[model samples]
Target: MKDIYLLSGFLGSGKTSLLSHLIEQLKAEGLKPAVIMNELGKLPFDSKSVDEDVPIKEMLEGCICCTGAEKMEAQLQMLLEGEEFDVLLIETTGAAHPVEAMDAVLSPYFASRLNMKGIITVADCKRWIDRDKMTPQTRMLFMEQIKHAHLIVANKVDLLSDNEIALVTLQIQGLNNHAPIIQTSNAKLPLKMITNLEATYSSQEIQQAAIGKQLSLSSRLHTFTEPVNKDEFEKWVKELPDTIYRMKGYVPLKGHKNPFLFQYAYGMVQWLPEYIKMNPQIVIIGDQVESIAIIGSAQND
Candidate 1:
């Protein structure tokens, strides 16, 4: 059985930094691991920062479940098919839902092959407390990611004083009663914590718990695709409707032969490459706007 770990959190939650740290540890311990980055932008920096120089795979242009779901399974199969590695570390986009991202991995094909080792959720401690600054859509997605983790890594604790640490710990405890919380700076902690981390998914109790009923389970997708030239994909993303919370999957470009990596989180757009597969699978996850414009609350009252 291959060990697979899912790393998820909100925007700027120190996921990349922490991932680099963990990669270092994995290499030092003589483990030849593989990395899968679920990113939003054109910048290909996550590969450079990690120490191991092991194979790094990126799931670009949207949330895992929405757009990158297809490639995710294929990428995993590619890694496991040949020489199977000791473990697989998957880092999800900041705004992506942790449970939904994990669910995409288990979609029929890879369900039996991969082991749901556990989810390690990283939170920007300060940004989390100042939740009011973010839009309702961002906040809603943020809380879902936090609550679903098997272990919540409270990152950027250095910004907080001693007393602030305790307060943050208590606050996270209030939100999630299951997962134990750990504090770290740039994910610089013991590899022991991760290697021995317990799996949170229980097959027996999960059926009784009604997982499908959670979140905006029933969502209507409205795709508005424009022929975005190579140079326009980044700038064009800012113009996407605010109602579109997440946009990703696969998309085409003017000059590029391969389909460009595309994903936008609450208006922030990221473009890049699909080294594994070059096909467009774009999906937009948002509230179905009524009529020509949005008025009052999109939320059903």
Candidate 2:
């Protein structure tokens, strides 16, 4: 059976940074690995950051555990059919729950082909402690991610003092005491240790637990295809409602030969030149995002 690793954590928890290092280490050991990167938004940036010539399947525009479950399974099937890799690593979006993510991966179709190594949850010290600022739903989602992990990586220790680290550790222990906690800044850990982390829960347990837990949360995905004026788009993005937690896509800014890739989260917006040109499109993810206000004139499709 092939080993499958699930990396789970909240947004900005450093899963991607750890993924890059893990990939490099795997390559150095002469082992081939494949990746399934789940993004809550349409445009995927983590896959591009891997910097490895390996099979990478991006399940975008929604969370793999919820809206993108079917697509993730399809991608997994495709990858399994194409090449044989020693192991598979799935990086879940920050909003993904480990139980649901694992449920999607352990579908009966891939039962014999994949053996789950373990679920590794990366907890951002700062973010984990800032629960008071999170919505009730968001806080529940965050706690759920850590509760199902076999190993909890308390990341960003460098950002905290010794006393703070202890406090954070105690808090995590309160939620999950069985999972071994590893401390690191930027999620740095021995690659071998990660590859060999023993799972606390079996795949069967994961599937069973995830059966009805999915219905507890409501997630929605919204896509926009029309291009808007660059200035107007920026203004719209700046004022996006708090209900919309994540947004990503490519936009054709006026006077730019290529469309720019945009990502927004936690009230911050980032835009950069895209190497590949594409029509204007954006995806928004959140709880009940019925619609977004259009800005500026639409460009010709």
Candidate 3:
């Protein structure tokens, strides 16, 4: 039977970072890893980070728990038939509800062929501290993710003060005492710690607990025709509404030779220089995000 692990987290909570690390660790252990990456945008930006040799199936333009569930089953069927992989790692969209995601993955047709490892949830330290500021629906969703996780990764602890870290840890423990919480920077942790975990909840429990309501979040994809001024772009980001939870993709700056990978979550923004030129596009995910305008009159793709 193939081992199956689900990567769960809120927007920009470092799921992809964890996924990359897990892939490397699995490869080092001489195990083959396959990934099924779900994205809210039309393009699969995160899947590009996966190693070329690893077989990947991208579920784009929808959350795995809802519109993409059928696609996910088909992808799983295809992966099972075409690949000889030891483990299957599914990176769910930030907007996905854990129960629903599990229900979708634990299809009766193939459940016997897979060993459900567990859900590894990454919680942003800062986000947890400021979760009260989130919308009621979003806050509930965030809490649900923590409540159902078998192992919780308290990521970005370095950014928080000593006291803040303690508070966040306590709160997480209070929310779900069943799961072991590991505090780390950049979602770094040993592979054995995760791969050995057994699913906390059974497939039947997940099916019974599934919440079928659609989340209010949406995503907008903007493709840039030319490089934009970095300063101007930063200014525009500063003026953005708090409703915009996450923004990420390759962005071309006027002075830079290659586009920089941009990531934004909550109110923080980061830019990492890319050595090679990438397609210039940005995916904005949030409540009512489609109405927002992109810089330089970029058209939505």
Candidate 4:
């Protein structure tokens, strides 16, 4: 049977970054890894970061727990037939509820062919501290993701103070004491630490926990026609309302030869230089994001 692992986390929790690391380590161990990346936007931006040689199936424009559930079963069927990978990693959208996502994956037709590994959740250390500022529904969804995780990765510890780190650790432990929490920067950790985790919940338990209402988050895709002034872009971000939770993609800036990879979560922003030229676009995910404005003459896709 093929081993299947679910990567769970909230928006901007560093799931894709961790996925890249996991793929590198798995390949070094002489094992083949495949990925199924889900995105809220119509375009599959995150899938582009995955290595070219690895088999990937993208579920776009919807969360797997709801509109994309049927597509997931079809994609899983195709992957099982066409891929020769040892492990399959399914990265759900940031707003996806863990129980519903797992239920969609545990389809009766394909369940027997896959060994269900434990869920690996990447918790944003800073987000946990400021979670009270979020809406009641959004906060509940965040807690649910952590509550069902078998192994929790407390990422972005570098941004926190010593006291903040200790407090966040204690808060997460209080929520799900059964799962082992590993604090790290940029979601970096030994591959064995994840692969060695045992399944914590049964199929029955997952069904039981999937009783809450689904979250209603939205996304907007803006394609940049030309490079914008970096300073102006930063100014716009500063003025953004608190409803916008996550923003990520390639953005072309004036004076740069290539577009820089940009990521925003909570209130923090990060920009990394990209050596290769990529399509300049950004995906904004949050509550009522369609009404949000873009800096340049970019059209929503």
lDDT (CA) for every model shown? Answer: 0.65, 0.72, 0.80, 0.79
Candidate 2: the clashing residue pairs are none
Count clashing residue pairs in model 1: 10
* Model 1 misplaced stretches (Cα beyond 4 Å): 200-301
TM-score for each model: 0.65, 0.65, 0.67, 0.66
- For all the candidates, what are their Cα RMSDs to the real structure? 12.1, 14.4, 16.7, 17.0
Per-candidate total of colliding backbone pairs:
10, 0, 0, 0
Better of 3 and 4 by lDDT: 3
Report the C-alpha lDDT of model 1 over 1-301, residue by residue, as the tens digit.
5677888887678888878777778888898778888878777566667655587777777778667878887788777786547878899888678756865665333443455566788988888778889899988888888877767899899998899889988988888876768898876757787666543223431111111122221122222233346455565556555655555555656565566667666556677776664434443334331212211112321
Off by over 4 Å in 2: 199-301
Give the alpha carbon lDDT tens digit for every residue of 71-165 in model 3.
98899999999988999999999999876786567654465466667778899999998999999999999998898787899999999999999
Preferred candidate (lDDT higher): 2 or 3 = 3
Q: Ten consecutive residues with minimal summed lDDT in candidate 4?
A: 205-214
Leading candidate by lDDT: 3
Candidate 4: the clashing residue pairs are: none
Q: Write down the worst ten-residue block by lDDT for model 1.
A: 205-214
Question: Lowest summed-lDDT stretch of 10 residues in model 3?
Answer: 205-214
- In model 3, the Cα lDDT at residue 208 comes to 15
Ordered from best to worst lDDT, the candidate numbers read: 3, 4, 2, 1
